[model samples]
Target: MNTATGEIHELWEIREEDDPRRSYAFGGRHGQFSFARIMAMLAKDSGITGDDFRVFFYCGIMTYEEGGATAKEAAEFLGLTPQATRRITKKLAEHKMLLVAEIIGRTIKYRASPHIISALSGRQQSEQAAAFHLPTLPGRSGSATKGRTNDTSRPVPRTHRPAGTDERTAAPETEHTDDVRDPGRPGARRRTHRG
Candidate 1:
C-alpha cells in the first residue's frame, strides 16, 4: 500500500494463462459447441440426460484430438461400463449428435457431429466434411431473423462494457452478435447469439 494515497496494483504475472470464463483443453484453444443443439439436448423435451451430454462430449473430444474412438476406450476414460458407453453412444447417434464411423474387430468407432463439438479449423473441417460426405448440420431453429422474434437478447448496458472496450463519446446500443461456424459443416446458414 502507498502511504500517501490509497491504491491497488496487480502484477502482469498475476494474469491467468487460460481465461477461466471460456473452456479450453490440452490444445489451449476454444472448443466449439452448437448453441441450438446444446440447448435442445439439455431441454426436457429432448430426452437427453446429463450422462448423455458427458458421453457425447467425450466422444467429440477424442474424435477431435485423435480421429475417433471405440466405446470401450471411452468407457475406460469416462469410468463407465463398456455396455453403458455403447448405449449412450447409440442414443446420441440416434439424436444425430454422433455417428458410427467404422468398425475394427468388434469395436465401433464414433464421431461427434460437427455441429456439436469440433477442434478443427474451418478449412480443415471443410476438407473432412467433403471426405466424410457429412451432411450440413442445422444450427439454430428457423431463419436467422425469424428465430429472434422473441427478442430474448438484451443490449449490454453502457456501464458494463469490458475494461479495454470503453468508448469516449456516447453511442447507441446495438444488438451485438457474432457468427461462429458449425465446425466442418460448410453450408450452415444460421447465426448464433453470443453475449
Candidate 2:
C-alpha cells in the first residue's frame, strides 16, 4: 500500500486471537482499526456521542512514533501549520491525553500519556497501562541497601557483590583496618591503600 497520505486505499480484515478488526495500510505504513474507534463504537452503544473521535484518532496516531516526529513534523503530517499544531497539542495536554516535555531552545517535544497509549489498543484495559509506565532513569532504578556503611547519596541502584565482600574490599588491611581486618585474614588484603 502507498504510505503516502491521500485517501483510504484498502481495507483489511485481520483476526487477532478470536476477535477481528479492520486495518488500513498507507505509505507502506499500516494502521488497523484503532482502539479509539472501538471506544467510539462502544460509546455510541452507551449513548455518548458528543466526543471527537477524529481528533482522538489523530491524537492516538500522533502518539505513535515514526522516525520520531516533533510537533512541527506532526503539524506537517496533519497538513497543519506549526502554530495550529501547537494549539492542538495544548488541547491534548489539557485533556491529560498527552504530555509536553522539554523545550530545547525553541523546539518542543511531546509524548502521549500511558492511558492514551493503551486506549489506542483495545488492550488498554489489560497490558497497556503498566507497559506504558515510564521507566526509571539511570541511577534511579531501585532502592538503596540499608546499613551497608557506604555512601548512598548517589541515585544509582544497588548492585550485587560477591558474598562477604564489602564495597571497600580493595583497601589494605594494615592501612586503616576495620576491626575485622587482619592482613592474614581469610580473604587477605588484595591491594595497599594509599590514603
Candidate 3:
C-alpha cells in the first residue's frame, strides 16, 4: 500500500519466532535508520557535509508536493538561514547532484539528482534501471556564456576586419617560415650559430 504522500507504506507482519533485526520506520527508532545509512553512504562517497546531507534529504522527501521547492522554502522547512540554504544548494548544483528545475523572478526550484532519486526509491539496481542512467538536467549545456549559443553546427557571423588586416595580411612576415628565433631581441642568436 502507498501513503497519501505516494511513498510505499511498507508493512511486515510480525510472527512469534521472527525477530526483526532492524526497523525502517520514520520515527521512534533508537538506532540508525535506513535513510540515515543511505545518507551516510552518500555523504562519504560524494564528500558532502552533514548539513548538505540534511538539506538534500529534506528536498528529496518534501518535493513530493511540488516538482521542487525554492531555497527559501527549504530553509524554512529545515530551520536554516536562507544564506546557508543558498550555499548548500550552490554546492550541490556545482557537483551536479541537484538541478534547478524552475526559476521565477527571485525563486528557483530544485530537484535531486536522478541518481540520488533512484537510490532513495530503492530502484538503483532493478528493473527500473533506465531512470538511473538519465543525462544531467537541462540548462547545463553552457549556452548562456557571454550570450553565446552552444550549437556548433551553426556558422558564426564574422565582423569586418580593419583595413590593414586580412587572413593573408594579418600574419607577420616571419610567421610564413619555420624559424623560431626572436629577431626583436638584440642579444638573441641566429639558428645556425654556436651554442
Which candidate leads in lDDT?
1
Candidate 3 lDDT over 1-195, as tens digits, reads 555668767687766666746767666322212454354435444456677878877676654546677789889988999999998886666555566779899788887655555333444334433543332222344322223433335544465677867657455445434445667997464555445
Give the poorly placed runs of model 3, Cα more than 4 Å off. Answer: 1-45, 118-195
What does candidate 1's lDDT look like per residue over 100-177, in tens digits? 878888778998887567777888766655654232222334312211222236553343676778668778555435
For all candidates in order, the CA lDDT equals 0.67, 0.48, 0.59
Best by TM-score: 1
- The TM-scores of all predictions, comma-separated, are 0.50, 0.34, 0.43
After best superposition, candidate 2 residue 72: deviation in angstroms? 1.7
1-195 per-residue lDDT for model 2 (tens digits) = 566865567786666877656455456443444365356334534221223233334555655643123567666666767786776565444444455555678776665555534324556534654654332111122411232212226444376666887756576536544334356778565554557
lDDT of candidate 3 vs native? Answer: 0.59
Write down the RMSD of all candidates, one decimal each. Answer: 27.9, 19.9, 14.5
Better of 1 and 3 by TM-score: 1
- The superposed Cα distance between candidate 1 and the true structure at residue 139, in angstroms, equals 17
The Cα error of candidate 2 at residue 124, in Å, is: 11
Candidate 2 regions off by >4 Å? Answer: 1-59, 118-195
- Choose 2 or 3, whichever is better by TM-score: 3
Q: Model 1 segments beyond 4 Å from truth?
A: 1-29, 126-195
| TM-score computed on alpha carbons, candidate 3 | 0.43
